[model samples]
Target chain A: MSSIISLKHLYKEYQLGDGSVFTALRDINLDIHEGEFSAIVGPSGSGKSTLMHMIGLLDKPSRGEIIINSRDVSTIDDNQTSTLRNSYVGFVFQQFNLLNKLTVQENILLPATYSRRNLDFDPIARSEMLMEKFGIISKKDSYPNRISGGQQQRVAVARALIMKPQLILADEPTGNLDHKTGNEIIDLFEELNKSEGITLIMVTHERELAERTRRQIRVLDGEVISDKKK
Target chain B: MKLQGVSTLFTSSFADFKRDKVRTALTSLGIMIGVLSVVLLIALGLGLKNYIQNQFESLGANLVMILPGSGFSGGRGPAGLAGGAEFDEKDVRSVEKVPNIKYVVPVYIHSSVITTADKEISGSIMGANEEIFSLINIDVQTGELWKKTDVEKKAKVAVLGNTLAQDLYGNPSDALGKTIRVGGMRIKVIGIANKIGNQERDGAAFIPYTTTFGSMNPKKTFFAIYLGIADKESVTTVKSEVEKTLLKRYDKDRFSVTEQSEILSTVDQIFGILNIFLVAIGSISLMVGGIGIMNIMYATVTERTREVGIRRALGATTRDILLQFLTESTMLSLFGGIVGLIVAWIIVLIVRNWFPVALNLFAVILAIGVSSGIGIFFGVFPAKKAADLSPMEAIRYE
Candidate 1:
């Protein structure tokens, strides 16, 4: 099967306030296959978040090529990046970045409104099914602030899946949840990977969460230290 | 995106506004006041102009006046000698012979005290020929007007205007045969003329021109001549003929003739300038309103930075971001303009009811257009700023 995502010799550098350059990621290479549930584990300032940013097409790498579904997106502008992200990738942020003002259903329907391609799924029915599956059905009309952190993250996941994107990039999606809720979120991701075959790329500091994924990579000082597949 | 999506965006924006009702109302209030001020100012200007125009129209269009000039040395009246020379009975007789000239009445005026048995009132005394009755419409409330024979014979018969009659005899009817003192001469009131509103001629006692010239002080040689044309259509021709006749009789360019319409046009020109001045004054307020909109929009950008980030993450393009902010600013201005229009209309109605002015529609439209333009022009910078925010940084913003 063709790889859903590929990165080669990726480098991301940031200029410090003192005008010295600090390398956030260096000469990184990675491939994520279809339906693969993978995690990038790292300490603070270890380049995992930077890598996730590049992978999600939210930030451009200083040097390298990134091919997602065989389309190279390394030098793309903001508009093209947004188009690609809307059509092919979905994001779940650590802060449960749901619009606090909108209800759960509205948050999920937001991506469809902005996508270049029409979303054929009935938003109401899709939201209903996702909420039912995630056991958040009763909270469909509730705002993000009214719900628990775990429920908010689940709603974020539901939003990410609404566009039927092939790739999901999650940045510490369960960092704010309790231990039980975090495990439950991971189990949901695993089930989505197994059943629906959506590739999952997550960045997390939790060793247990990283280990649960089928593939794991560890980074230190902006370079990869280990890569293993079970 | 489809139009349906745009409509959805509008609905969403409206919902958001509804969610924060107080802020929305406050923002709209700024716009409303701006619009209201512009509309009311323009309306008031128009009303004043209309009132002035109507006042001019009340003076008959075919009426013409001849003012005397002193000399033609430098188009300047000589010092110690008044600028305009005086016209005499000969000039009046010559103008009377002009073709299409219906009537020519020369007026001589002075301020004097007139007393009855119990009351004494000070007012203006005017001396005019019998033709003055035909030249100007004056309804006699009680008695007959002095005949042309009375003027020819230099008789002391007089007509009392409504105010003069009221002052001399207490009742307009009783003033008919009463005698009024004018500069030491007693003139018998033969008629009590009808009341004319707020005009210079409305409070005067009228007597024969010969009688006034004989009895009153003799140094004032100039007389104001009122020429009534036979045909309204011949007003221009009649005016020129009268001027030519007077010029021939006077044997110099010592007279100036003015048509009522010319005076009315001059008045209109003045009001037009006044309207422009008022509009300029109102524009300053509108500009302030524009700045208010810009200030509020800047605040909105800062407050909704996270919302902007969320929208960006959801795949909104920079253009979308720009449009959203622009739409918001424009909506604010449009709402303000509407509110202002309503307020202005109310003021116009009140003024129209209370005063003599007429309301016009052009000023209302101008107010609305100017206010909306202010909104769009001032809103662009903030919208661009909001649109240019870095999605990555914005999303990460706390």
Candidate 2:
């Protein structure tokens, strides 16, 4: 299978105020393939979230070659980078990250609102489809804070899928949910992967959650220690 | 961005305003006050100017005056209004002989106390010929005006101003045919002039210049010589002719001959300068208003840091974020400007009945344009700060 996103020799460093550098990601070579359900698994301070940010194009690497959907994005300007990220990738943060000011329906269509590209498909129609499919169409007009944590996660997932991105990057998507709610979210992701054949990359510190994925890339101290395909 | 996207952006941006209506209104208050003062001051200045123009136009356009010193340039003559040259019968006769010139009224003006049987009033006394009534638009409400024959005979017949008559006799018409004492002379009131709306002129009394010679004027010299021209077109010719005639008898520095329109324009020029000064004062308030908007924008940017991050993550470019905040600040300023303009318009309408104030197109345009400009000027720094935030860091900000 072709890779949806390939990161070559990625390095991320932060300069501390004390005139010292802290490396977040070091000498990373990874490829996330199409239609694969995978987890970037690590403990706290393992640089797993930073890796997800790099893949999501939310942050730039100090040194790397990033190819997203077969397009080299490392050298693009900010406007181009934003457009690429808008159309090519979807993000699901650990906190749900739903804007409380907007309704559920508005939230789902948020990605397409910022899309600068000429989209072939109608975004509103697809947002309704995602909401209907997720069984959250009844909550379309509800705000994020007014709904349950599970509902907000579904809305976030629907938002992630609305643009028809090549890759889904979820950083602890079920981190704020209760155990049963978390299981339901995992089930939702499992169904999206198996039924739609969409590329899914989840970042999780929980070992059990990582175990549910079809493949696991384990990392420690900014370096990948293992990559296993179950 | 697409049309729908732009709409969405505005909807979301304005939602912030909806949530904090009070903050928005308060933030724009500085701008509102700034715009209000500017518009109102301009309206007042315009009204005063219109009032002056109407008053001059009502007095008839062909009137000219000969004064002591430089006249409209400052002095009644070179000595100024305090102690200027006074014209006499000879000067009046010379000015009247100029072609196209009409009645030449020689005036000897003084302020003194006039006493009736039981009441006494201190006011201006205009000593002039019969033509003073028709030449200056003064109306006589009771009896008859003292005639030209009254000046020839040095008759002690007087015309009392409306307020002066009313104050002395409770009603102006009652004062008719009554005798009033002025400077040891008892003068009979032949007529009472109507209400003239001017403070000083409303409470005055008029006597023949011939009667005022020994008792008040003493030198038998006139304070000023006022001429009426037969045609508006000949006003300049009559003016120069009178000036030449006067120059032959008196030094050019000692007397001034000016058309009435020249005085009107000189007063108008003074008002123009005053308006400019008022505008400078108004602009200071506007600058302070701009700074007020900037301060609030900075706070808003800080408050919305997380939102900025989320927007960036959702594919908003740096420029998008910048434009969003910049537009918000500008909208705030424009909101103030529009409100101020409306408020000022309402005030002008209410004041129009009593005064001549008006709001012109330029003032309206300035309110909107300046407020928006202030918004943009003050908004840029905060917007730039918001746009410079890294999306990841912004999202992580508490």
Chain B TM-score of candidate number 1: 0.78
Model 1 DockQ (Cα-based): 0.41
Measured with C-alpha atoms, the lDDT of residue B17 in candidate 2 is: 82
lDDT of 2 at B84: 53
lDDT of 2 by residue, A1-230 (tens): 98888999999999999999999999899998899999999998999989988888998999988987677787788999888788788888888888888899988887787888778898888889999998999999999999999999999999999889888889899899999999898999999999999889999988899999999999899999999999
The 10-residue segment of model 1 chain B with minimum total lDDT is B71-80
Interface RMSD of each: 2.6, 2.1
- Clash totals in order: 7, 7
Regions more than 4 Å wrong, model 1 = A135-137, B1-5, B68-82, B86-88, B107-223, B232-236, B248-255, B356-359
How far off is residue B278 in model 1, in Å? 1.7
Per-residue CA lDDT of candidate 1, range B1-398, in tens? 32226776676777677788787777777768766776677677767776666655655648887866632122455422254557777777777788887777887877888776677878887788887776667768889889889988989888888887776666789877777667677778888888865345568888888886654747535467878887889887887777677666663446667777776777777778988887788777788888888998999899888778877877888877888888778777887888788777777777776765444667667766876787778889999998898777788888
Candidate 2 — which pairs collide? B47-B356, B68-B76, B68-B77, B69-B76, B69-B77, B69-B78, B70-B77
